[model samples]
Target: MAIAIAADELESLFDALPDVVFFVKDAAGRYTHANLTLVRRLGLKRREQVIGHGVAELFPAHMGGSYAAQDRRVLGGETIDDQLEVHIFPNRAPGWCLTRKHPLRVRGKVRGVVGISRDLGRPDARDPTYERLRRVIDHLQQHYADNVRMAKLAELAGVSLAQLERHFRNVFQITPQQALIRLRIEAAMHALGTEGSIADVGVACGFADQSAFARQFKATVGMTPSAYRRMTSTKE
Candidate 1:
């Protein structure tokens, strides 16, 4: 025999989970429903405020624009699975999260998107393997402007190249190389907010050239660095 949970009960279960945000958006990218976790993370006093609102209404332009593009992708019948990316918390803190989005289909037509984002706790504090990987992550963060070597990271973690890749995937669901790129992209995002030249920002973030930085930045952020900088600058 098996037990079945009601719809409301299932929703309550999702609401009770800590550090997990859940949401549903319509084809137009309007919020149709959001869990309490999402509501709180958006700093909304009530879920009603989130209903019918778009990401642009709830978040800054740079972040919201990325989210809107993601919604469009899902609504176009695409599924995004277990992507490692940065998220903004309710208190305005930036953190990494494993995010997934799927298209909601009704009668074989894509109606909207349903998504969840699970916060990744401090990279250094997750477990013994993660603790070991922390040294590499810390070094990457500190030296994002310089070329990073996987062999050196493996050496720092007291592991071989294969083991380092395995551990990084097991613990962070990303390759060490991907993590390094993410770090550089994050650093570039921060640098874009300053008065520095775009090429200078790319150089500071370890890209081989401004073209390379723009390519990677657009791939990861869903917009060019110049567009992001313009949107964020206007917001500020």
Candidate 2:
């Protein structure tokens, strides 16, 4: 309904979050409020173009436009939950969005719609036990900067620590702790490659100390953290 000059600072705080949340409107039936993460996933230039744009507007042309019915019901006041398969233009690579959609109420009546979506592209979300264990993974990924424990992960996943481990193995073919290590370490590597310092990368990815980060980095990437930074710098 309006051009997006700037994201409301109150709301844009969520944009810094890892989860890719954006508003979905029935009238436009496309995304408004596309967070930085969502835009990156779709390889889009800016969220500004999406504001006030319709599905018809997102794609110059698309096949079928299959989601209109589901959108109509939500706009008509029925809550719907589904995993959405959204089509991004160009290559049309499939993107999975775990979504819960409901009406946007104003005073007492519906105005439009609101939906929150989390991308499920990681190899981790493939578990048959995922609906059970992956919620833990989600929680950890969300608060990765904090002190997260196996017990906390288990509580979020609604399973015992042992059960969480088994389900994580069944789905991701790795132990839960191993999965956590891989995620954190890989996150550290990404931060380093993207212009973060050795200590900054370590802190952002949850290692409590630089020595520990260097130890884990060498074990995973066969190089110390400083060495990796030097190598990356040389290549650039």
Candidate 3:
């Protein structure tokens, strides 16, 4: 005999984890369940405030639109796994997270979506590859404005490409490629706060061009570079 757990029980279990945001959404993209971490991040005091709302109702316009679009893809049967993202916390601070979303199937039919966004934890210094990965990270930070190659990173770490990827995920909870992208994005975000043109910033951040930079920035930060700059300007 198999035991079935209730959604409420699962929600409660997830609520106990302070660093993870968990949710279930119906086919219409309305939230059916949300953990406390998500609620608090959205600046809500109670679960009821989040239970029936959609992303559009809870997040800023640009970010809400991006999240809703992602939900639509999931509703259409796409699975998003271990996607690196920058999530906005309650005080408008951005934090790194790895998000996963899957179509919830029931009785051979897709019913909804279930997802989790876990906060990126501190890297494990005890991992044997930590020192090697540290060197790679240092190089990324120092040279994010230049064209970066995974093969070069592998060589720097003195490991095969496969081992480098595995070690990065094991220690940092992200791939070496993701680490490089994170560095570039961080630099771009800082530069966006200046008066420099978006295109120039894109190229200076090691993106192939403006379009690629805008695409990656919007995909990870949930807004276009100009929109982000405007928002940040308004805040300042």
Top candidate (lDDT): 3
**Candidate 1: TM-score?**
0.74
RMSD of 1: 4.3
Which runs in model 1 stand beyond 4 Å of their true positions? 1-10, 89-91, 124-135, 138-143, 149-163, 189-194, 214-236
Output the TM-score of candidate 3: 0.97
- Residue 82 of model 1 has an lDDT of 76
If ranked by TM-score, best first, what sequence of candidates would result? 3, 1, 2
**Tens-digit per-residue lDDT, 141-192, candidate 3:** 9999988888999999999999999999999999988998899999999999
Candidate 1 colliding pairs: none
Residue 57 alpha-carbon offset, candidate 2, angstroms: 55
Cα lDDT, all candidates: 0.80, 0.63, 0.91
Cα lDDT, model 1, residue 209: 95
Regions of model 3 farther than 4 Å from truth: 1-5
Candidate 2 per-residue lDDT over residues 1-236, each given as its tens digit? 23233334524765776666656463546655566665665567787766766655553322223345556678788996643333333453334345667886666776667766665545655556778765766776777767778898888777888888777766765566666776786677567777666888898898898888886665444446676566556663
Best by TM-score: 3
Number of the candidate with higher TM-score, 1 or 3: 3
**Residue 33 Cα positional deviation in candidate 3, in Å, after optimal superposition:** 0.6
Which should have the higher lDDT, number 1 or number 2? 1
